[model samples]
Target: MSANKGFETKVPENEGMDSGYMSGLVSELASGPLSEPISEVGSDSGKRISVSVEEEQLDSGLDLQISEQLSNLSFKDVTPTTQPLLVDLEEHKPSIIPQLDRLFMQDDDGDTQLHIASVHGCQKSVSTLIKVCPQRAWMDVSNDYGHTALHLAVLSGHDVVTRMLVLAGASLDVRDVSGRTPLHLAVEARDERCIKSLVIPSPNTPREKMVRILNMRDYTGQTCVHYAARAGRFDIIHLLVNCGADILAGEGLAGWTALHMAARAGDAALARAILDKYGAAAAARDFAGRSPRRLAARTAAAPAFAAHRRDDTDTDSDSEDDYDSESDEQESLFEKLVQLNNPINVV
Candidate 1:
């Protein structure tokens, strides 16, 4: 075997040597056989290593070749020490396009960049951001309708988004600038799915005391049922009625009832349905003194005609005879006044 070699290391006296004689003796012994050989060394001192550009390029090429060869090698051929390093490098490779699509699509807005992520359909992103950076999401998130993500999802008929927001402990009754609720938006959009999703039972309350919390009125004092009436949507009307809408609830400029609205709209079937189910007591009287019946009469004359027909035959014929006798008496009095005007005719 080659003799063990150690390079002589020198320390300046100013560097502080605590054991001068022992260190020097040890250094002398280390330079002889029995010392470990040094493979490579480096120093902070300004020293240049002689290397040509061609030699540097060749070394770089050799390193690249070795890396490529290692990459091509199977896991079975890799050493245990290098397996974890290769795994880390492989794990850092960019995800596939479809995987990225799925990731972004899982969020509502389908945005990969963090800055552009807060958008209307991006319910997942909005929810995630609500936990991650609530202030930013609250301040910056807006949808296509110039509404915040909450408003957009609520108004655009996305119940899932609404529920996600609510579950994340967002405010339930927050109104948009228009002073409309998510319920109002659901009604306006005629989305029963969203409406059903919002009908939550009260927590730890008596069943009788658990009043229907949703389908409340907007700033216009118009409930969801009122919107259904105005739209002539009987299915929505039925839904609202079943869900506890008061048929007698008055709203709008004229404070019209659902029955009155149905009448005014000339929706005879809907009017009849409301009247038969809720009773005529629910009919409203507008400022014009027109009740549901009166308004209905304007559009449908059958009821009015029937009413007149019932009264027409009840008049007494003797009343007409008495009126004729009275007219005869008035004619004689008129003739007397005429005679007084002409004295010769009177004689």
Candidate 2:
């Protein structure tokens, strides 16, 4: 019989209200006067109820529901399994690129910074030295065997680092104290990339300079091409020839040519290629007076040496032609010398 008797509804314990009633209560609360006393009531059935309190509780419950829905909406589909949402997080990680050290850290045998860089693949450090301390990068930088930075890079097969050093104005023609250039290092390492990169002409260097570098003799007088042949790098021999490296060039106390080295290394293909393209002049005598064919004949490549017999015959013809020209020049020179020495005979 009370004013709210018919509206008496059991509010279940630990149970939430229906959505319609919750919405109506929220609307009533928004429109009603402020400062109204909030209270709770209980039905005879022991179901707890409150006029204003139910509305507030329902609003709080609705707020919680809305908050949950909003949270679900904001969640990404690709949420990570670990950790809560955070804007930023600090993480420990190793660097992808290598860090470089000082160029000249003193070690047992005075190993240079360039030496370390080459052995460890420290391109960054090598590059830094080239840019910041070029003089230090160049000064007395050698490995235990007296190889230079170019030598080390060549030995290590670090083509990019080698190119960087060359472009940074590293002396392409500078030999180790042993007189071996980077090209010689490439041959020793049998690295075609280093050889190719080193042989290619740079903007600042002329073709003649490149050729001179290729022909540069080490302390042993072995040219870069000779080393390539010795290392059994046939491709390099071809590359050198195409670049105009003298086919007949030799060095060392033994004066070995590229062909001689190839023959000694038992590289029949390289020897044949050299003879075929550049002619038998390439296989001519070294300081030991042994032609590449003779060296090959002594090796397991005797068949290759025999194959070049016809070429050697042609080479003999060329030699005869050269001797004739030289003999004519000698006669002309002798006549001039006699005329200069005995002017009274003309009178």
Candidate 3:
């Protein structure tokens, strides 16, 4: 040890500086002589590294778990960004003020929230909006296209929404720019559910009102049945007829009935169904004094009508033959009875 600050400690030089001794000295300097066993130190360092790796893995696992939870809890509405519509008045009590007035807020296209929700098939929003609607008439608010929410709902194939609107007293008679009522649009869309929804009997809608709606003519003077008939929807035509659509009633300048439209379109099945359902439609004349039977004669439905007539003729001939045979048998039996009664004089 040197007392001076600049002095360095000196050691005696060894004349026998063996390589093994030098290596031992180096090892001792690198690791303090008082340090723990090499194995223990190495294990401790390994444990530290392993702990760091384990910590990283744990953090990653936690992150993955959190991500999975978030994915599982994810929710979406009709639109991803848009929130649900107004609260249902009968279900949840709204904390804030009622948004009934907001429902009437119209866009540039004059479509209200009801109309938008209806077309988007947002059943929850539609149900809430209908519940909170200030008036039944507001449900009929139309867009620039003159389409009410009901019309848009039906046209967009949102049958449930259409039914909701119909039950809420939305007018089915409102005509659009195309002069088509909701019923007409339903038939045009060929949506059986929407059609049934519209025609389903409701206490708010009278039978006469439903009939009027069913037969209500569009700008083209075509009723819903006419549209169904023109489209060769025999089932829909039958439905409309059962719903009080006048099959024999004429339309437009031609005054053509649904049968006339079916005949013109060469829908033999539809023509037959119509004529069979309402026999008067066969003889029913259009404005041109042409009946559906006459129209069908020139179209592809002629053979169907011919076969139908032949079948009718055969049925009538069979009935006549049975009547004549019965009459002859009765007359012969009566003569035998008379002869038997006078058998004493004759024999």
Top-scoring candidate (TM-score): 3
Top-scoring candidate (lDDT) = 3
Among residues 3 or more apart in sequence or in different chains, the pairs in candidate 2 whose N, CA or C atoms overlap within 3 Å are 103-113, 179-218, 221-252
Give me the overall lDDT of model 2. 0.51
lDDT (10s digit) by residue, model 3, range 184-209: 98898788877877786665566778
Clashing pairs for model 3 are: none
lDDT of 2 by residue, 1-347 (tens): 11112452222223233222122322333334211333333334755432231222212221111122211222122222221110110121122001112334445555655555544445444443443231334433655566666666666676666665655556777666556777877777777767665665554345778777777776655676767766676677777777767668775445667776676667777777776777755447755355666556546665665676565242423233333555445434433433343323432
lDDT of 1 by residue, 34-88 (tens): 1222122222353322211111111111111122322232212222121100000
Clashing residue pairs in candidate 1 are: 108-121, 108-122, 109-122
Better-scoring candidate (lDDT), 2 or 3:
3
Candidate 2 has its poorest 10 consecutive residues by lDDT at: 84-93
All candidates in order of lDDT, best leading: 3, 2, 1
Q: After superposition, how far is residue 268 of candidate 2 from its true place, in Å?
A: 3.0
Q: What is the TM-score of candidate 2?
A: 0.53
The parts of candidate 1 lying over 4 Å away from their true place are 1-119, 133-148, 202-215, 280-282, 287-289, 300-347
Per-model TM-score, in order, reads 0.45, 0.53, 0.61
